[model samples]
Target chain A: MYPANKYYVKGFVMSSYSERLNEYISMVNNELDRLLPEQRIPQQVVIDAMRYSLLSGGKRIRAVLVLEFCRMCGGDVAAALPIACAVEMLHCYSLIHDDLPCMDDDDLRRGRPSCHIAFGEANALLAGDGLLTLAFETILSSRNLAPEQIVKAAGVLSKAAGYQGMVGGQTVDLQNEGKPISGETLEYIHALKTGALIRAAVQMGCITAKADEGLCSGADEYAEKIGLSFQIIDDILDIVGFAQEMGKPVGSDRNNDKTTFATLYGVDKARQIVKTLNDEAKALLKRFPKANEFIYEFTDSLTSRTC
Target chain B: MYPANKYYVKGFVMSSYSERLNEYISMVNNELDRLLPEQRIPQQVVIDAMRYSLLSGGKRIRAVLVLEFCRMCGGDVAAALPIACAVEMLHCYSLIHDDLPCMDDDDLRRGRPSCHIAFGEANALLAGDGLLTLAFETILSSRNLAPEQIVKAAGVLSKAAGYQGMVGGQTVDLQNEGKPISGETLEYIHALKTGALIRAAVQMGCITAKADEGLCSGADEYAEKIGLSFQIIDDILDIVGFAQEMGKPVGSDRNNDKTTFATLYGVDKARQIVKTLNDEAKALLKRFPKANEFIYEFTDSLTSRTC
Candidate 1:
């Protein structure tokens, strides 16, 4: 299950983060296929389109967080699969809608035509809607989780994904697209738009495991630090990364006139912010000695990744 | 509280269905206002648009079904309010998406500008997504319902709304527009699109009430009959009822060149179909004497009214 790339630092080989990520991605991708409707049903096109948008390559960072945090908290990773998959669905839903005609209107996703381009806009719209609904459906129908925890997980995911969360953040992002926006506003936008779900992914894992208060707080703080770092690094990568490396065109933010960390504070400051966030995240992870290894490694790999 | 309008038939003056419907509408609307995010939040625009469409005005027919059915099954209607509100949210989400620019492209809904018209299409789209997510979040958050029942209800609502349900139905409806459609195809479309949620509402009440198997089957039968009847009456009303009465313009079906029962069969035949469906619904309702009274009266109001 190891990815071919091995991280080498100062001559000692690091346990390859790519290998662990790929392993989790394969696991999550399978569950997602099982969770989504297959093509035999009526309106098979919708299911096909839904699968198309979801199965296309993404790093599966949220899924890994759910699993790794569950492992950290002594929860069954198998039982946490549904919650892990649900976060990915939420992520894909946002991408599908964000690329719509009236929205960012992007033609590419993962170097492929976006859902709206591959399927018609209307179907893409429904596909996004279907995925969001299915996220709950998957959790509600999950085989291993307790009912109370299922409800808790649903609340966490939805609160992060709903109007006051990702949807709300996207609204602000859309409204301020071409217009000048403050760093405070941008922080607010990404916190919900991207960070909210990241935070939820870790929280859902803690809930699934029934982790103690201290561990839960640690996970939350860890998630927030990495969440901010993730977005800042994403902003950095889009400017300098090649299309082949990033799996999509570079400088999309500039093309779309989006204000990111790079635009506001310069790349050096943004990189410095990412480094600071990484240190803070690792410090938070220190609370759980047994579970922090994968997480710390994961965070380190995230900041240093070219894509 | 009894409505002033009395239905005089066979020497009995049945309480006014309008008064009962109005009563439930008021309660549901208040809760809906409470359930949706307030304008003070950062994504105030998304919440504002969501409330504008949901609060504008509709019969709240689906919401009433949940309460009445719960009451009939001897369950607490107050406890059922969350599920009731959830169904309406799902219904509203579909309407918003169905009226989008690439879909039906309708400017009006309930005699006012649709969500896409009032808000821009992108915001309208997000509003629909936000409501759909909120529906699950509301159910998962319901304090009155048991966790097990919440899970069951989520499965029911999502299945009825997802690819095999309303979304699937709408897909067919969109594809078949402007083309000659068979009666079977049309039935398939409406069954998923309209009948699914209508059926889900009744089933939800049954589940909430913890009704026995026979009663659940009876509720299902009752819902199917009424659901079909509702559409037939709607098709019939468009050709004959006043726009003022219906709250939206009439002849929209003909204007859009979409096929319906009235279009495929003669108007007289469509009216007969409504009569037959109403009779069948009443027959199924006979299984529950206490609950059937309001449902029967409600069905009568539905068929005989100009609106």
Candidate 2:
């Protein structure tokens, strides 16, 4: 999951960048909690089911990426919060459905009972649907953003979550479960399944900032590289990371006979490819002459993570 | 399901309205077909499965309502087509998910295989997810609509599809299944499950026309009453209508021990309630000052049926 002790030493350094990222995550979580209220409903069970998987505690990477990218593009973080919350909501929906008996059929999610396991299968399905609809609601609730910006942002999100992006990726993933997939096909699957949302995150930031089209396209390219690299590293972690450390079952992919980068290409080759992609991602950011420090540090932190 | 012999006379006379409705449905189907291209990909089977359900014949009542309501409110039908298409997409998603093996688990829909039965369980689930995501895509594609109108329409659709609407109704319906339900509870379920989308259709029409809030709200009230009345009449039909007339099994509600209006209030009382609600719906529209012929005819058509 990480490159040896690099993150260990970085953690010991108490860097200002790390502190700021932590602060941003905290704020995003606070906003998310406020937005998804569990106390206002008559059926406490349904609300609890929603909160269970929602608050199970992941890295909050999507939300942070949205906020940090907006900040790096010289946009107000406050204006980006709704989109950030939306990104997480979309992510949560994916996870909820992924854990369904018809899908991944996993009993545990984030070391707790999956939504379907906690609530009934029916409620889990509704909870996921609710969250998906709520994501659009959050984006539409961006009262602070310009109407044009909101439209653009909604477009990005819809494309990412729709047939061409995450759902398409998932469709391909499910179809190719027991079959041997070519390297190219696997890459296409990962690009849609995982890379699309990440790309949208960067584009959302630029659009929210009302950045020029050239810069927006540049950020997209950068996001594309980093997103694929992130997935490749995740594939590697499935093989080497411990279950306790990852908070998810290790080697579940291998057990399911699912296609992964490590399965198609050896670990060393996958690692080398991710490194090359990382370099390309950094190079793409060169077009932004006045890039913020957080951008560089965030990119570095992503490629250098250890679990 | 129309009453026998009644169709022989009225069908010929109402052919013009049916033709207009068919033209509108054809436009929606064409748009959906164009959006979902049939190509051989790994996910083609799942895409086809979703297309099968979508293309299967139905009344397209929601889309027609959107178009007619827009026309009645003095808006271009062309401008409302995207929102109209969106309502169908949302409705299609609900049907696909509702037919899942974990949900309703029906073998047939619209005289064809259900999504799960045609596709595998996983792909069926993903197909539903894909359809839901695509609903937003369809709505967001309304680039011709003004930004404020787009925002308003999106808000209305989202609210109708979310917790306070369809999902909540489904949850309550699931919980109340096979149990004795009060007339009020049944009404509540029908209102949220069916009425919400019906109300949204009228609201979308008014907002797209940039009509005053009073007019929109009045139309929505009109829609809500009719929507509930529609469902109550449906329950009445399920108990008394024949399989040949309805094109599906009848008395399945009693066999399934479902607590529908007829089960809760007796068939005669349910029919009477439908009449009352239809009257109430027509009364609400009196506030519109000048009613179009379509509005009057549509409202009259709802409760006047004798299947």
Candidate 3:
């Protein structure tokens, strides 16, 4: 599950935090659009499918984490921009594959027809494959990073996205559908399914900034807290949030009989857990030498988001 | 359209070239087995699926190209073994995806149930995802190469595997199924779908060897000729090859009403083209200063295979 757009909450007002978030979102969106491959003859549809899902607007939270963490670690945001986009590309690929008929079979994503629905199943499959491969291609294309740094960053990403991480988690999740799973099993699934990539995002930013080992460890711990909280928020939203804001049907988790935090512990307890985890995440951020007020607000804002 | 097992062909006897090729295959298989992820909790099935396809026996020609080119360019074979396995991992992933029901819908691979048929569509899909991501992880995990060389080799691989290459060619191949297509389009498809990775295998080898640009270019030219001939041979095999030796059913291309070199140019003419192209490829190899007698014999052996 990913964070949704909260800019249009009923009583929300644009603050400096909102403005900076918007700026980061715009920068990432522009770069993603610029980096998308041109539609060459005979293979234009595959490229079109890739662009359609990639450019479809979301909050760009994963990408923002990469840039904001880099900035927090005293790294050049421009230098980390490609890495930021790479994570987003990888995330988009997961979403596409997760929506396939043989998988979750979802008909929509971010309030639009899913990749398989918009493009036929075959092209959609290839689109996911393309995006996954392109994620690595994008990372290696970064001109500002040293080759060592690039290799390290790619290793982090590939581990997060590979069999031991996201794909492995998805396999378990699908296999357990409609079965009674324990709390520990659920946690393991979420930790690998989503937590791994979030941790990689923070760690990659630190590596790009040449942060110390201790700082990387601290950052990873912070990422773990926020990533879990993010998932809890997602479960809560599925039960109580608006479809218009959430960009997908509400209560689909319950409809599918999925065992989420809300289903296991109830929404109130899940909210409590999110608050505690996010607070700890923000507190952990304070240990970083270059952490700033904007970073604090950004970390806290996810806890209060309705969408 | 990979090269089939030729060592077991009637009247074929083990020679120095075969012995060395077998040695390379055994090394790659051992390394791949060692590198495969342990069967972790709740995710064991995905790993099983990944291993099932990857360890299925093939000639390992693409991987051999990586190692042989590295050797031909005077590089350490041990240092490049991981790269060789990386290309093999990538090839296996592509085959898994290509056999999916939403794609080519084949029910068999390497004389067994295809990945989707063996593991179910969803797990097979994740298995392919796992292998593709693992390919990059395997490359970066190498400790023998310089960081720059690793980065360069990874870049070559990602480009060959991504939208502009393998995936793009697959898209066109699927779109043109059961339809009339020109020779130019057929060439375009084969060049990207198969040739790109073959070219990358050679290029990555040269990069690992620190070969000069002149030698890299010549290696690439040789790879191109052999790669094209490889496809033409595949088409020829589809028409005349034995199912027992070819592993999958022969003439399935015709069964599926697919356009192929044999269909477009006739088997005799396709064979003639293969002979001419392979001769040119072998002659080009003679230009590499360290190219050995075994390398030439190996190249020629492919042209005369019956499987």
Candidate 4:
């Protein structure tokens, strides 16, 4: 929107960004596979549904954020690995539930049939519940973190994922579906729906590294800006992106009559917001000399076009 | 199938037992109300759904178990109250999910409209998920318990409530619906679907007390016996008890063509099993002299006639 008459501006992603993302994504996938229960006899169907949905291909963005932040803070990632995986598992659970017929009614996700489509609604529901429970259990099983840290992490994740966070946001989103909500309302929804977990990811990075309060507070502000920016970009992508690149079909939000950031602010203004957010996030990253490069590239990579 | 020609036997409930339960229920209800989220604006719909299902009238058996077990071990209940509430929250969440259309397809629970029926499917689903998250959140928020105890409680509750326990059992039940299953399989399903959480409640009680390993193991065995016994009695009640007394329609198990203890073992034998398990539970209870009277009355109360 800021680039004159261009409706969608595709930022050129650095080749090195792709390389880092792929390597980190691979690492996350391996750890996820190692941590998840094996699909075996007696509970095969349930475990299969769990593994299928959890191990399903994705960007591993949340896990990467946790790991990257910890690394930036000069902490060993092995200490934060389970926490990283926990966030991903929690995110996956939300995705499964959001795809349910009663929720968003989507059949496709990440270029494949959604969990409910593959496992049937009942099993899909259980799989979501299972994955969510496993996230907390996985966090508890983290060997490196002290019990106090584990308690803090679990408390943060649950609060972010619970009714006051993701689920709370989903409720508002559902209730407001087909109705025109105020721009403020839309922001509130997005903040809770997506922002809470994102903020928690950054906080966990601080928690694992036992970082200073200053860094933690800085991370909070950075997360909020980036989180809103990310959702806005997602809204923009839903309008202008390809179905193949996005996994699900395009324009479902428009079809559902959802009041989105793009709908309220216009595509151009939304993109402008995204640019502002990216700059602000980069500005915050600048404070941590070591975190600057990777954080900038990692965040910058999200808003850029995939196809 | 049992002693002489008694195909089924219903024990007479003591007035004294009812008095004790009523007092305990009142106390637990107050704690639950204290613990649950208030009906607040901005996300009132979701919070309302949560409060509705959680505060819906029911026997506070799970909560009482946690409280009583702590008391039996001579610990201050103030330290265990949040944990008591946590287990109840977990139980309530399971009930909500189990009643979903794709799962049990229930439209009624506890003599009232089921969560989905009352709150709509999407909200009900979120309510269930919210409650599950809250269970852990509630545990972490325990002010009196140490961080380590909180960690241990969260671990036990999540494992018991997760895929390997309740969710896993529900999966098996759904897969085997209307199909023949072995007695061993039925036992496995009940143990996970119901027994797991039951065990957790008792274990949390022991954890809160900081009990010795011997007492913990004893609690485990006692929980196992009473848990199975309780489910067997529930199966019996579903066949012989009135719908009004039970709060929901009966024979749905039969209508659904699902196999139960009664279906496989015969009513008299099921009753016989209940008696045996009750004896075993009591035998274990006797070892903890301080826990004897309350534990006996509570477990016995569950199996006896209520109306």
Candidate-wise lDDT, in order: 0.84, 0.79, 0.88, 0.84
For candidate 2, write residues A100-151 as lDDT tens digits.
9888788878787889988989889988888888888888878778877887
Q: lDDT tens digits, residues B182-280, model 1?
A: 999988988999999999999998888888999999999999988888888888888888887776778988888878898899789998888888888
TM-score of chain B of each: 0.92, 0.89, 0.94, 0.92
* Candidate 4 Cα deviation (angstroms), residue B294: 1.3
> What TM-scores do the predictions have?
0.93, 0.92, 0.94, 0.93
DockQ, per-model, please? 0.74, 0.55, 0.83, 0.70
RMSD of each: 5.0, 6.2, 5.5, 8.4
Candidate 1 lDDT over residue span A104-156, tens digit each: 88888888899989989989988898888888788888888899999889989
Residue A239 of model 4, lDDT score: 88
TM-score of chain B of 3: 0.94
Per-residue lDDT of B200 in model 1: 96
Q: Put down candidate 4 lDDT per residue, A1-307, tens digits, no spaces.
A: 0121221111223336566666567767877888775856577787888889899888877888887777676666668878888999999999999999999999999999999999999999999999999999999888888888889988999999998899989998888999999988898898999999999988897788787787888888999998898899889888887888789999989998888998889999989889888888888876664574556878888767522
Residue B268 of model 2, lDDT score: 84
lDDT of 3 at A168: 88
Tens digits of per-residue lDDT, candidate 4, B100-130, equal 9999999999999999999999999999999
Q: Any runs in candidate 3 off by more than 4 Å, and if so which? A: A1-15, B1-15
Query: What value does the lDDT take at residue B301 in candidate 4?
Result: 79
Range of the 10 consecutive residues with the lowest summed lDDT in candidate 1 chain A: A3-12
Clashing pairs in 1: none
